[model samples]
Target chain A: MHKKLFIPGPVDVKEDVLQKMATAMIGHRTKDASKLQRDISEKMMKLFYTENQVLLSTSSGSGLMEAAVRSCTNKRAAVFAVGAFGKRWYDMAIANNVPADLFEVEWGTPTLPEQVEEVLKTGKYDVVTVTHNETSTGIMNPVGEIGEVVKKYPEVIFCVDTVSSAAGAKIEVDKWGIDVCITSTQKALALPPGLAICTISQKAYEAAKKVENRGYYLDLVKLYDYIQKKDHQYPSTPSLSHMFALDYQLDKILAEGLDNRFKRHEEMANYVREWANKHFEVLPEEKYASNTLTNIKNTKDISVKELNERLAMRGYTISNGYGKLKDKTFRIAHMGETTLPEIKELLSNIEDILGL
Target chain B: MHKKLFIPGPVDVKEDVLQKMATAMIGHRTKDASKLQRDISEKMMKLFYTENQVLLSTSSGSGLMEAAVRSCTNKRAAVFAVGAFGKRWYDMAIANNVPADLFEVEWGTPTLPEQVEEVLKTGKYDVVTVTHNETSTGIMNPVGEIGEVVKKYPEVIFCVDTVSSAAGAKIEVDKWGIDVCITSTQKALALPPGLAICTISQKAYEAAKKVENRGYYLDLVKLYDYIQKKDHQYPSTPSLSHMFALDYQLDKILAEGLDNRFKRHEEMANYVREWANKHFEVLPEEKYASNTLTNIKNTKDISVKELNERLAMRGYTISNGYGKLKDKTFRIAHMGETTLPEIKELLSNIEDILGL
Candidate 1:
């Protein structure tokens, strides 16, 4: 059965976008490939609202997240965590042997700008990692305000993981002073799960050049240098299939207008949140709740696994909370190409299954 | 025009194989995904002729190559270079700040067993990297022979790159004592470029455990642990679209019978070599020529650029050498699903274009 995905990522890719993945293979080093990559990069810059260089990788978003932390952090790093995804950044720093300290709030709470300001005042860190929209806890950090706070520290590199929120939310990268903003194709991008995309400021690239033992595969300095030298070509053979589809999808996205797309996502999120409020409580504070996915507390104490099984039978699926929050909460994603009508239909089906 | 690709990789993907890439996306954490991955792993082991654990990465083959060198080389690495890809291994080691020494053979020559035996005798290196098939030089190194030499030094971990010649050539991974054998999907796997596949021996896994600063994204130990604990699910989201296609393609390859597939590749290689010898000189020594692609010396002084342009007009494309050998030689790949009739047609078209 073709179950509709309301899960966090690898969300339902439209047929046209999926068809683009089947485009004929082209030589990665050829002029045709350069054009494809350049086109994607330019389109991504518009979407990200950044003048920084857009870089692409053939791995998941975590690949670029690791790249950002390992390559740009020459000194110590202060990692602010709100959920599982935020903790992953700290873990990446530790694994790479980059000096880092993790400042984590309660899972459902947001990372406040004051906390960021307090950490930067210490002068012990040269880099700060933040998750703009954490998928696990359904909390969207106040990155705009946090970015304002980070701007005061000229020496620090600010890196944000907008994996789930990128295209769904308005992220003014340059205005926010985000040095490196990373996202993958699977989430709000509404594409398959192969490619990861990011934009890096000149400051981050310069810092990356000074970092030692940054590794080769995900080295930002090398990646930036290679693309610049080879006219947007990667050092290694990339997934051209993903690139072709991304190019096509990006066109569709731009045609829809960024503001309009963001508005659509906001509307869908609002609808889902309203529906959740009527039956269960939203996991995060209403003000900081994510616009891409919603984590709802299991107020009725329904068996998530059984509910999912029933949903699956109905040709629909939603995530049963993540990590420690499993069974205690459930998540319904509203990002990507999800429509208002689709959200209503899914919610209606859920209500029928649960008798809510 | 839909040109038939004869390049070393990103080679012609059959329509059936390409169609598989468009399969609907599924949650990476779902049971369906686990089943897909487990099936791929089992099939890959059969194709690799190994009982070792198979691992998959969403990046190109270089990602896993970087992983092996960075994760397992706790002491020093002795990188044996037969061609461009070999030098890349050394480059990766240096970039990661791993201690490594490069042993280079002439471009067109193979890495002899004597050289590996000599290096292992030094006892200065704990890990050794070898390219089983040098794509740039069209030389298939004596890996089976080199493996015998490596067997004498049980303390040294052996990593082999079979990127361009795994499914198209006969490689008995277990018999060759290969600790880490890596290959990407694009080449002989008859799939689009994206996923990289490798098998790790128990010895290599143990060595990786003791290594520090392995990084987070491509950390082999973490990847291994995750797959073991989660039933083949990766720590990071994978390119599930590729997995769907890989599962389908593996069935086709296995159904064709491994021995028959090997024979087909051998025949195609022999036929191309004979044609090259009749009109142009083959680049690599006849004894060590690859069974996947043939590098032909431009002894007739024909303009490869013009020849490719003409070929392109006729709905065909072939590689115009690589790096320093550009224009001096050209390559024609016969890997994956390329058949006898297609080879004959491509050669006949080339002959007509060159007036040979």
Candidate 2:
């Protein structure tokens, strides 16, 4: 059965986008590859809203997260955790032996500017990692506000993971002073789950130069050097199939206009949120709800597993809550090429199944 | 123009294999994904001829290479370099801050078993990295012989990169006593250039348990644990498109019969080698020449650049020597789904172009 993906990621890729994955292979060292990579980087720069060097990796967003924390954290790192994905950054720091401290807020809460300001006041950390959109909690941290605070600590490299929100939300990487902004192809980019894309500021690259043991495969310095040295080619073979689809999708996205795309996501979020408000309570604080996916409290005490099973029988599937939040909460993701009508159909199906 | 890749990797994928990549996306956290992953792992175990665990990564083979050296090397590493790819392992060790030493023979020369014995006799290393096939030099190292030598040093973790040779050559991971054997999708696996696959022994897993700083994304221990915990899912989202193709292609490769596939590759290698011997000398020693890709010395001093240009015009592409060997030698890959007729055609085209 073709169950539509309403999960946080590996969401519903368009048929056309999926077809692009079948594009014939090309030599990684060829001019065709260099051109393809260069084009993708250029398009990604526009999507990321930054002039920083855009890089691609043939791994999940976690790979880039590890790279940023390991490469840019020359002295120490202060990792802020709003939910699961945020906590992952701190884990990545520890795993790579990058000295770091983690600060956590309540699960459904956001990472506030005041908290970031207090952390930066220590001045001991050289890097700070933030989750722009916490998929686990459906909480979009006030990164713009946090960026304002982070800007005050010029020495601290600012890294933001917009994995679940990059294209759906407006993240002005340059204006927001984000030294390293990371995202994967499966999220708001509306592509398959292979390629990881990120932008590295000059500051982050310089910081990486001072950091030793950055590791070869995910080393930001080596990645950056290779791109600069050989046009946009990577140090190792990349997923050219993903790159081909990405290049095509980015064109379609730009044609739709960034503003229009963001509005579409907002419209879908508003619709989903309004439905949840009537049937159940939203998990995250209303002021900071995610535009890409919504986590709803199981106010009716419904079995999420059973709900998903019912949903799947009807040719659709939504996610049970992440980790500890499972069963207590269920999620409805509306990002990445999911149309307003599709979202409505999904919600209506849910309503019918629940006898609401 | 549709240039058929005669390069070492990112080789020409069959249309059916490419179509598999176009398969619909699925939620990474779902049971469907687990089943898909489990199926791939089980099939991969057969392909690897190992009872040990098979893990997949969304990056290139180099990713797993880094993982093995970084995760399994606790005390120190002795990296034996026969060519560019071999040296990359040593570089990965240094980049990850793993204590290591590089033992390099001349570019086209093979790593002798005696050299490995001498290194193991030192008793200073806990990990040893070798290349099963060096793409750059067109040299397939005597890993079977070297494996025999390595077996004597029971405590040393043996890592082999079979990137360009895995599916085309017969590598009995269990019989060879290899702790970690890595290969990628684009090589003899004949998929695309994204996914990396490897088998890890219990000894390597235990060694990894004691090693610190096995960064999150490529952490072999985390990958193995996750597979065990979740029944074959990865720690992060994988390249599902590549997985789809790999699952399908593995069936095809197996249906062709591993013995038949090996014999086929050997046939192609013999035909190409004989042709090369007639026109020019093979780069590597004849006994050590690779059965997948053969590097031919530019003995006639013809313009390799011009030859490739002519070949490209006729919808074919071969590689010049890697890095410093460029123009001084050229490579013709006969691995993956490449057949005898295609090899004959490519050779015939080269003859017409070179007037040989």
Candidate 3:
């Protein structure tokens, strides 16, 4: 039996969506491919609430995350980290020989707008990256507020990693002044893990054009140029299987209605948080807690590893705290196709197993 | 009706293999995921005839092509271009600011062994990249002979792009002293286009370690280290759908027996060549012709684009000449799971459509 994935991503995809992965292959250079891609981009724009040109890559969200930093950072980068995912942006900058500085808050704390303003005031940075939702600590940062602050710096490109957020929450890209927003299919999009999509503002493209040494494969400027020249087709042969599924799934998501989907996610998040409070303590404060997943402090000091193992036997699974927080915290994801009833069942099972 | 893919890549995958792509998702960090990847690497070793470590990337083969040039080329790179694919190697190196020089041959020509030796003798180049098969011109370069020449230079890392020929043809990585051999799943592997696999020898790893700025996402050294430390697991969340399908398809490939598979490809190539010679001029000399795809000169000066459109109407598709060779030549791919009778049928349809 497959354990229900209540972990961050690679969530329980719907059976109908999985069937779309088996769609017949198509020549990527043909008109059919361009139409498939164009339709996808149109839907993605509606979801992101932006007029930015959306780009698709045959990689995990990390691929585009790396692309954002390597392609957009010209002078220097200020990466604000709430946890592991934010730190990855900094790591990518350092790996690519891009000059950068890391401004990391505590694992469970959100990156405030004032802190971002202070960094931009330095006038040494050309790029600013923030984690819209940190999967590790379950802290959803105030990206709208941060975007307001970043708008004051016309030269700085604002990029956000919404890998685990996106469809579960409202991301007003244009209103937030987001230059680039990156997310993968597996998270709130509720598809498999092969493709990553991002919205690129014209400013980000112009900023990237000024920077040299944006390596091929992950070069954002080059990708933008190719899509413009090729009528919505990508430079490389993209995963048409993923595109087929995404196109279908996006319809399903839109049919659910964006406002209703966001509301459903919030309801699930509140239920999980309430349950966590009764049993243990929520890791992050109520205001900053992520709507996609809830991180619970392991105050009872249960063996999270063992708990997960037992949960697997019961056909339910959740994530232990990521990296340094392992054993100290546990996480329950309510994103993807997971619903409130499913969350209640998982909690009930956990209660039965733990005899709480 | 779905048109069968006859292009170089994104080939027609078997229905069973396509179904495997719809396999249920699994956490990339799990032991099961490690087993799946480990199984793939072992089988890939047999296919490539090497003991070198096999690394998988979620992006297309170009991703790793850029990785090889960026990570291993420290002093300088000598890129040999027979056609578009080879030129891409040089393009990637230049994009990443890796100091490199291109030694290009005319279209439909192979990179000769003596030419490679002459370039290596210059001693300024520490990395040499060759396209083993040029999909555009259907010229399978004399890479084994070129490898013999590159072996003399102990300091130069040899990289080969076998994207179109890796599984359809035999590649003796260790015997050829090729440090990095790259191929994608959509080609001879008969899988989807989302995954690319490569073999990296210890020498390549050591050379990459000395490089200070290997970008993150496509960083070969970082990937190698992570695989070693994590029991064949990748650092990023890999496309589990691809891995599941690859693991299943590699079994079918091994069951087919490598020698038998190569013989089938050669037999199909010979059959296609005979038809091409009788009807149209064969692009590239017979000695250098690729066994996977045969590029035929449009000797009669017929409209290749119109031919493809007509072919598409009959539930079939073929490629027009690529780039500069467009309309001058047309191509038919006989790789992947394509059979001899299917080739005969396709040719018969083209003959009937064109009044050959």
lDDT of 1: 0.94
Q: What's the distance in Å from true for residue A248, model 2?
A: 0.2
Minimal lDDT window, size 10, model 1 chain B: B11-20
TM-scores for chain B, in order? 0.99, 0.99, 0.99
lDDT of 1 by residue, B1-356 (tens): 77888889898788888998999989999899999999999999999999999999999999999999999999999999989999999999998889999999988999999998888898898999999888999999989999999999888999999999999998999999999999999999989999999999999999999999898888899889988998889999999989989999999999999999999999999999999999998989889999999999999999999999999999889999889999999999999999989999999999998888
| Candidate 3 runs further than 4 Å off | none
Model 2 misplaced regions, further than 4 Å = none
**Clash pairs of candidate 1?**
none
Instruction: Give the residue spans of candidate 1 off by over 4 A.
Output: none
lDDT by residue (tens digit), candidate 2, B177-274: 98899999998888889999999999999999999888899999999999999877888899888888888998999999999999999999999999
Q: What is the lDDT of residue A230 in candidate 1?
A: 86
lDDT of 1 by residue, A141-194 (tens): 999999999999999999999999989999999999999999999999999999
| Cα-lDDT of candidate 3 | 0.94
Candidates in order have lDDT scores of: 0.94, 0.92, 0.94
User: What is model 2's DockQ versus the real complex?
Assistant: 0.89
* Chain A TM-score values for every predicted structure, listed in order: 0.99, 0.99, 0.99
